[model samples]
Target: MLHKWILAAFVSLLGTSSLLADETTQARCVVDDKRRQICLDHPAQRIATLSPGATELMFAAGGGDQVVAVVTFSDYPPEAQAIESLGSLTRLDMEKLISLQPDLVIAWVTGNPAEQMERLEALGLKVFYLEPRRFADVSSTLLRLAHLAGSDDVGQQVAQAFEEGINNLQQRYQNASPVRVFYQVWNDPIMSVNHEHLIHQVIELCGGDNVFADLPRMIPRLDTESILSANPEAILAGGMGEENQAWLDHWQQYPHLHATADQNLYFIPPSLIQRPTPRLLQGAERFCQALDEARAKRQ
Candidate 1:
């Protein structure tokens, strides 16, 4: 009876998967090791990106025209400004989404909850979650999404350029002292990317030593005193918006930090820093250029 029960469960799972699979097989797309489902057949011609990062990636993959709708915060590229606005990635406008009738929904793992994605899938919408974690993963994610969207050649071209840019940046800054960097993502409690995160990868690529590299947590909670103790050389305020500005005005409180004395504290464009997309290479290159300029001025 127990064996029969296990066999029945297996059959049920297979049946459910088959039922879902019958809904759509628009394309065959490579899924990365992270299990990001990419559709190879239909190619997401009428697409709705869930967040700014996904928007940036979609543009990079040459799917600008296929993008029928975007969420509220996808304001970087001028093209995105004209697209229909859904709600924020965290809180979607289902009604708006339904109206757009996107063949594929390029959703986010972090911003959009899993429940909403499941709901969309249950409604027979083809939603693929292409979330990536590290800098090395960005190129793959872009390429994979491009292939899924039927822009594989364009995606590969962009990925190659991005990779080449990173290589150039690393070579240029190969000899510099790894500037001790504290990249501020959130300000109220003083937070930074956890070690092993993609943003942290950007820091390393730009020849900076992450102060929190050894910390056990990815988004570890810490107090101001802890930040003071870390005493980073360069303070990068990746202001998500006005909220990150407090750090820019208040660093004077900790006069001992190397950044304060040398006036090395600065803000990189959040669009480039916050997202794990091709633009992050832009962020790395910008940081390297800034560090070079800072060095020249000091000399």
Candidate 2:
């Protein structure tokens, strides 16, 4: 009877140990854009953003304090500028990145070098690829990043607000008259976006037709003659700085063009529009207002 009691107690202790181990090893899983399942034993405590957009997204996800490193020009949320630098998007300080000991790294699909990401992965670091092209993608990515950082509550609030803002824009512009628009990304080469670009989506969202939306490349380079031929009704350019109007002024020389003749020149800050994050709602709102002003001019 003494041996039987001892054996029963040993069995119960072993089961309790197994249960404790299982409880300590809980895992969270998320599927990335590349369609790979990434599982972590626990929420990531340290994160590194490899692009300006990624940095902004991290903040939007309510994981700003967890971000230990970022690339150049990550000036949004103001707090990001103080973070450690991993160099620019094209160049990275691998040594500094390793020293940071980030549990997770957010990489831009085409922005970050493939080889560098591979090296990080080989070193057993988890990498999450971000390339948000649509408004839904912008919000969903925030939620995903927040989930990884164990800040789902903040992430969900931000994501919901972004989606709601976009829906409001769509409803407000539902009956707006369409305007012909020309968006200049660069002044020298006269770069414009194709229909697949996010800017084109913003144009359509504002009830505007992008004259260069049918271009073959994602970002196509054109000549001044092309603009003269298209003669868009409104010209919107994101200049070098927040208030630089030189790009718009250059169009004043072409008085014969519809845009210049009617003075439908507007400026939207590049940072607000260029980076795919929660801030895009502001850019889209500005774009809709500009198109509305152009429509009023026609009357």
Candidate 3:
């Protein structure tokens, strides 16, 4: 009777262990930016990033080794440049992407083509969409991507660090004096971002008020007349390339403008500020310093 009882207990224990294992495998589910839940039977071993920002996020999430494919301009971290490129943001090389056979694909919600993303899903590839518009979103994206890539430990560390870094900046500049600013997004069309855009948030963070904050469009096309009328205290711009300072130089042509008068036109690297990645913190630091100099000139 004792022997029979021991055998039954052992069998029950084995059954419980098997059930727990199954539960572990089924628990992998993360909500994408689209508010859709994406699940995988197992943590993804093969991953693909479809945008430059997505590539940087995956690497920051500690999933660099898992990335098998990437799109053009996914050049940050330097190592990503060597990865197989599926093509540009607008057009992807479908055949090459398919050949890679990535179990998971990280896509940009606004940057990537919607139809192509649908086709990837239709083909049975798991797609996780990321659209990090806020600072908190960046940390959350790292957590989610790391969870999918089985790098949660590293992801948590990175996410925490980013949150802390941004918090530090917020605290440092929370009481800073406001400087009226105009941030030029593009030169040919004379574009600037509205208050709703992330760049505007960065401006606010640095205690610089966006001159076009009340503009209806996110990226509004402005004429030189409107800019001259507003006459912002500081003008910040990113150029076509990382080291290009010509955009700021263009402001010099308007010698009477407050920014140009005070020589407050600043050049911020497009990759650091324009892309919503960890490097944005570095950009914010530079932007804040520039604003401080603008303030100093007043004294």
Candidate 4:
């Protein structure tokens, strides 16, 4: 049984609308993650993305030009950096946001502050809440967002490509030997994801067992002692930036550990893995290759 949120998102994806009620003026309608029917009288001309992932997804849907405002750290696709920033997700500049007058607001359900989204909805802005926790959700969202922006052609192509890529990865690694994996989302407080997290699914896809998948918390804060006890054969981490190796390096001190002794510490760029978008295919590939290397060490 899937979580209600994931199930609703999956159902919504299947009903993604591509047929415009009127070709001259797109009457875009979508059932967002919140299960609310959001129908724009016309195609969304001015769009505001309140999260980095949403900004990336909007661009993937070929609505880059329609994106008038974005929150901080939306630096993916390189072009997103040039868009006007409405500050971070939590502390949005309402004055600047209102001035932009977005017809559509792509919001992150869990990432953004609830009050801010409520305010936007209260002001009669069409808010599409998206929290993609599955691979299918990511690809389907591309098509759904594209329909909203009147860019169905590009959205379909991108979404199809994403689906194909994920299928290929799944086919390639589905029967491979499972490797024990510990994925470190954050090191200081020692945050790791449970089975509910998309990253855990990535691990399973790559034939890796997330040692902490059964933890009740979605992202559980762990300790070095507990990690040592679990004894994952390979450890993967994402750091502050693409090139930062400090997080992985920190584990070198525990040379007695299987991962450390075998030098199986790997780094997958946080931007690619952390964000739930088409880019995850690239992240998943990299992750699979890392596990392959870890398996090689055992031989």
Candidate 5:
């Protein structure tokens, strides 16, 4: 399901590659706990982000003007959707990437495959890998991107706004009501966010209990029976679109679920929840307001 060249293209971008031009500033890199790498300098203005998260960071950093191309999966901020579609994260069009001639390429090291990174290296493309494991790291990464894009001012503004939203939510939810929420990311079987993840962090921020908090993966497969047992007061379905209306609406048959029985299930765009970009703060604030109103009505 994953394309190999995507990884090649990214690895080629980071450091010590032929494309690594002699820059004015000495190159600096930091390897995260996941052993993933990122480039802090020599940022290209004509950038091409190859994954959703990178796209989010670029937009947050005010580097959208520099984004020459983006992947098919990047649809948020509306402006990003206008870029040339390079293809899916897993299925990169190598020729298209090369032909686009972007000065910088960003990739999700964790999402991309080994072979692909190697190929990009062989071709001498400058790739920056963004591997985010926690919520706070998203802002840190955005700062790095902001510096790269020469938009430190915009990045600061965005970061401040996001942090303010988070602080306000924490204050609002502290020592107060906590909603029992089932945040479903996917469902053929079922899937949910984990405790160490940003999505879970967002849920917790909203004064909601993540039904699958005990699960240990960022996005883990779950069982429907567990949902029946957890009996979440509300179901916040992520990745919802027109195609899933029929499927999500079926929760009605599950009489045990408070979400289903009372029709409390809600489908907000995945971008609002899943994206760790600055926009998520707005998303969180607005969604929490709705949740607060819903809880008050129920009480």
Candidate 6:
């Protein structure tokens, strides 16, 4: 009877040990922006980011130290520059990326080359895609990335802060008078965003109406005639570089235009508004302030 009891106790201990190991190695899964489920046997320890935006989001998700590889133009948070580069967003050095032995890769849905991503998957590498089209999407991305990186606590905090910042902006400008505005995305082709684009949402959040919001394409090439016909009250532009106001200067030739006439041509830094990250709150604040100034001019 004593021997039987001792054997039973040993079996019980073995079962408990197996259960604990299973808990530690439990699979984690998250659906990427592509709506495909990505499952990992355990939280990723090494991560590679394929785009500048992906790099920024990974850092925001508290996986900065785990970032083993990054592509060119990933120059945010200032520390990202120190990471090893695989090359530009359009072209990646696949051999170098494979040599890093990243357990997970953060890819851009529309920005990255699909063939390269496919090759990674074929080699048994896990890849997660991201494309944040809305403010809520950004928060969700933070949480998802953190889940994959085993930094859920930090992700939750940063996501909450970003959501609160955007909410504060929405409350501040919800009732302001609408300002007709034209946002110039590029000067060469004179590109403007439509309602489907994120920038247009920012314009609406600030109680402003986008002059080209009705355009068919997300980024529509425009002519001087269409812009003059709209005659927007405010013109906001992000030039080739931060603080390069040369794009705004081109509008000076059209003195008859309301935006030029009222001196409502505002130059916004490209990175702030262009990248869909936590910093968008800063861009929203600047955009709202610009609209407020335009409103003040009416008085």
lDDT of 3 by residue, 53-119 (tens): 9999999989999899999888899999999999998899988998899999999988889999999
Compute the lDDT for candidate 5: 0.70
Q: What's the TM-score of each model vs. the native? A: 0.83, 0.88, 0.89, 0.93, 0.81, 0.89
Off by over 4 Å in 5: 1-43, 242-247, 297-299
User: Tens digits of per-residue lDDT for model 1 on 147-179?
Assistant: 567786787788777777777877877788667
Error of 3 at 93 (Å): 1.4
What TM-score, to 2 decimals, does candidate 1 have? 0.83
User: Residue by residue across 211-260, what tens digits does model 5's lDDT show?
Assistant: 88888776788787888888988887765562354546767888777877
Candidate 1 Cα errors over 4 Å, as ranges: 1-26, 32-36, 240-246, 293-299
Residues 40-98, candidate 6: write the lDDT tens digits: 77778899999988899899999999999999878898999999999998899999999
What TM-score does candidate 2 reach?
0.88
Candidate 4's residue-wise lDDT over 63-102, tens digit each?
9999999999999889999999999898999989999999
Q: Clashes per prediction?
A: 6, 0, 0, 0, 13, 0
Record all residue pairs in model 4 with backbone atoms less than 3 Å apart, i.e. clashing.
none
lDDT of every model, 2 decimals: 0.73, 0.84, 0.85, 0.88, 0.70, 0.86
| Candidate 2 local Cα displacement, residue 66, angstroms | 0.4
The model with the greatest lDDT is 4
Error of 6 at 3 (Å): 58
Give the TM-score ranking, best first.
4, 3, 6, 2, 1, 5
Candidate 2, 23-103: lDDT as tens digits:
567445555666555666777889999999999999999889999999998999899999999999879999999999999
What stretches of model 3 exceed 4 Å from their correct place? 1-23
Task: Return the lDDT, model 3, position 234.
Answer: 97
